[model samples]
Every structure is written in C-alpha cells, then in structure tokens.
Target: MARQIFHRSTSTFPADKVYAVMVDPDQLQARLDELGGPGAALLVYAADDGGVRYRLRHGIDPSRLPPMLQNLAPTELRIERTEALRPVGPGRYAGTVGVEIVGTPASITGTLRLTDTAEGSEFVIDGTVTVKVPLIGGKMEGILVEHVQDLLASETAFTQEWLARTYT
Candidate 1:
C-alpha cells in the first residue's frame, strides 16, 4: 500500500524567479549540495520548460538514521527527481513531479503546482510514497514522509535565502 503526503510552502520570491533558480544548473546544484550535505552527487541535469529534471545520489550514513530504517535502507540513496511544469499563465505553472529511489521498490509521484500570490508564490506538493515491501510498507512510508518533508523544509529555507541574496 502507498501513503499520501501533502505539503504546502510559501516563498517570498515570485514564481518566475523561484522557477528560474530551480532550473539554473549552478543554483540547483548548490541547493542539492545543501540538501545532500557532504554526500551530494549530481548524476544528471536537464532543463525543462518551466522547471528541470535532475538525478541526485546521496550517501546517507546509517548512523544518521534509526536502526529500523538503517536496516531497511541502504547506505546510499540515489533519487531521480523530475520537475517539469507547463506554463498555465503568468507566474503559474502546473506539472507532474516524481521521485524514484534506485534499487528500491519505494517511489513518489504527484502533482507540483506553483502559483503567484499576494505574498509572492506558493508551492504545493501532493505526493504518494509507495513501498511494495510486504507487512511494513505503511511504517516505511511514514519514515519516508518525514524525511521528504524535512528535505522540503531545508530547500525552502535555502531558496528563500538564495533569492534574497541573488535577487538583491
């Protein structure tokens, strides 16, 4: 069975600018570095219409995870994440996003929406994490959900700071 994870984040930067940084190779790489910390590797990068498609490999140390997860997951987790949105109108993009875990039955797929707002912009992720493993898929999904949510929070902070410094 699969579990659903919904996330909402607000960015003070406009949608276009946020999208710009997202697709820029240098900026995106840097952000991945921050997300992946010392274990970040950029396997691939491809520019898309409103966003980009990229693959990142992260060496997640076992010590950083609980014993249960440590045993369930490998020492390294490589995720191929894709973000491609078509322009719906000014400052708005709608597209599908997906995350695939290498060598694992776990994967995430969902809708990614970016829209301009009075504050600046909003990002909404409605994703489902599926683990085909029997008897433990639900528990594993909880762990993955928390991990992904943390990643999103970290990226949001990074993007906000980057926008402030880069845009200024």
Candidate 2:
C-alpha cells in the first residue's frame, strides 16, 4: 500500500513572484545549499511560454535514516526530483512533482497548486509515497512521509526568507 502525503504553506509574496523565484536556477541552487543534505545540485532547469521545469538531485545522509531503514537504504540515499509548473489561470499555477530514490524501491509522485491569496499565495501539495518492499514497505513509507513533511516546511521557510530579502 502507498502512504498519502499532504502539505500546505502560505507565502507573503505574490504567486507570480513565488513562481519566478522557484523557477530560477540561482534561487533553486541557493535553496539546495541551505536545505539539501549533501552533494545536492540542480541538474536541469528550463523555462518558456509553456511553463517551467527543473530536475534536482539531493543526497540524504545515512545517519538521518531510521535504524530500521538504514539497513535497507544505501550509505547515502540519492534522490532525483523533477518538478514542472504551468499556468492554470491568471495569478494561479499548477504543478507536478516526482521523486525517485536511486537504487531503492521508493518513489513519490505529487501535484502542486499555487493560488493567489489576499496575503500572498497558498501552496498545496498532495502526494503519495510508495515503497515496493515486502514486510517493511509500510514502515518505510511512513518514515519517508515524515521526512518529506519536514523538508517541505523547511523549503517554504527558506523561500519566504528569500522573497523578503530579495524583493522587500
């Protein structure tokens, strides 16, 4: 079975500005430097009238993994992540995100929605964490969900700070 993951965060910056920063390679690299575990890098970034798409690689320190998962995971979990965003309407955007744990049977797929709010923009993520393991797949999925939640919170905070510093 797959585990569900959901997260929502609001930004004081407008949706357009938030989307602009998210799609910028330099801004994304800065975010990785701050929150991405180790050897994290932006592997691909492209933007056009169609929308924006980027790929990133992130490394997860083995020490951070739960004891039960440490045995099943590599010394460092390498994750390849891809995100794409397209305009849904004026001041609104919709996106899709996918993540794969290299050399592991774990993956995550999600949808993102950015809608304009009076205060700024509301970002929402709806996703599932799937692990194709035997007896421990559920446990692993739970762990991953927790970690992803934490990571999303951190990224939101970072983006907010960046917007305040850069735009304010």
Candidate 3:
C-alpha cells in the first residue's frame, strides 16, 4: 500500500530567485553536501526551454531506518533522487520527482509545484511512499512520512539561509 504525504512551505525569496537556487548546480551540490549524509553528490543536471532537471546520490545507513526498510536494505542503501521542473508561468513551475533506493522495494513518487506568493514562493509537494513488501508496506509508509517531513523542514531552513547569503 502507498501512503500519502503532503508538504507546504513558504520561502522568503521571490519565485525567480528561488527557482534559480533550485536549478543552480553549485547550490544543489552544496545542499547535498550539508544534508545528504556522507559522500552525497550531484550526479546529473540539465536545463532546457521547458525547465531544469537534476539527480543526486547519497549513502544511507540501513540500520538507521525502520525495521521494514532495514530488512529490505540490510546493508548500506544508495539513494538516487531525480527531479524535473518545468515553467508553468512567470513565477510558477510544475514537476514530477522521485526517490529511488537501490536494492529496496520502497520508492517515493510525487508532484511539486512552486508558485509565487506575496511574501515569497510557495512550495508544495504531494506524494506517496510505496513499499511493495507485503505485511509491512503500510508501516514503511508511515516511517517514510516522518522521515520526509523532517527532511523537508531541514531543507526549508537551509534554503532560507542560502537565499539570504547568496541573493540578499
């Protein structure tokens, strides 16, 4: 079974500035260095008329995960997250993103939207964490939701700090 996760955050940076930070290679690499655990690196990046796409790789200790996840990835887990965002308007973009954990039955699929707001940019992520291992899939989903929620909170703080330093 798949469990749903919804996230929303407001960034003090304007839409264009926030979008630029999201697509900027250096910013993302730095972001991973700080948040993506040990040896996290940007694996891919691209830009086109439509928008931007990037992938990041990192190592996760399976022992730190929930019992079900640890069972699925007994050893260290390699995480690959890919995201693609395309411009929807002057200050809005819609995209699909996914996280792939090698050697595991769990993956997260979702949609992301970034829109301009009076104060700054509104970021929304609506998704589901799907675990294919029967009898424990729902449990895994619950754990994943908590993990993702924490990650998002950390990311928002990082973005705000980075934006202030780089843009302001």
TM-score, per-candidate, Cα-based? 0.89, 0.96, 0.95
Candidate with more favorable, higher lDDT: 1 or 3? 3
lDDT measured at residue 31 in model 1 versus the true structure, 0 to 100: 84
Model 1 TM-score is 0.89
**Positional deviation of residue 44's Cα in model 1 after best superposition, in angstroms:** 2.5
Segments in model 1 whose C-alpha atoms lie over 4 Å from true places: 48-51
| Per-residue C-alpha lDDT of model 1 across residues 129-157, encoded as one tens digit per residue | 99888898789888989988988888788
Model 3, residue 12: what's the lDDT? 76
lDDT of 2 at 153: 92
Clashing pairs for model 1 are: none
Task: Say which prediction, candidate 1 or candidate 2, comes out ahead on lDDT.
Answer: 2
- Model 1 C-alpha lDDT versus the unseen true structure: 0.79
lDDT of each: 0.79, 0.91, 0.87
lDDT tens readout by residue for model 2, 37-72: 788999998899989999999998888888877776
Model 2 C-alpha lDDT versus the unseen true structure: 0.91
lDDT of 3 by residue, 44-157 (tens): 999999899999887778778877668777778888999999889899989998998777888999999999999989999999899888887898889878988998898788
Positional deviation of residue 3's Cα in model 3 after best superposition, in angstroms: 0.5
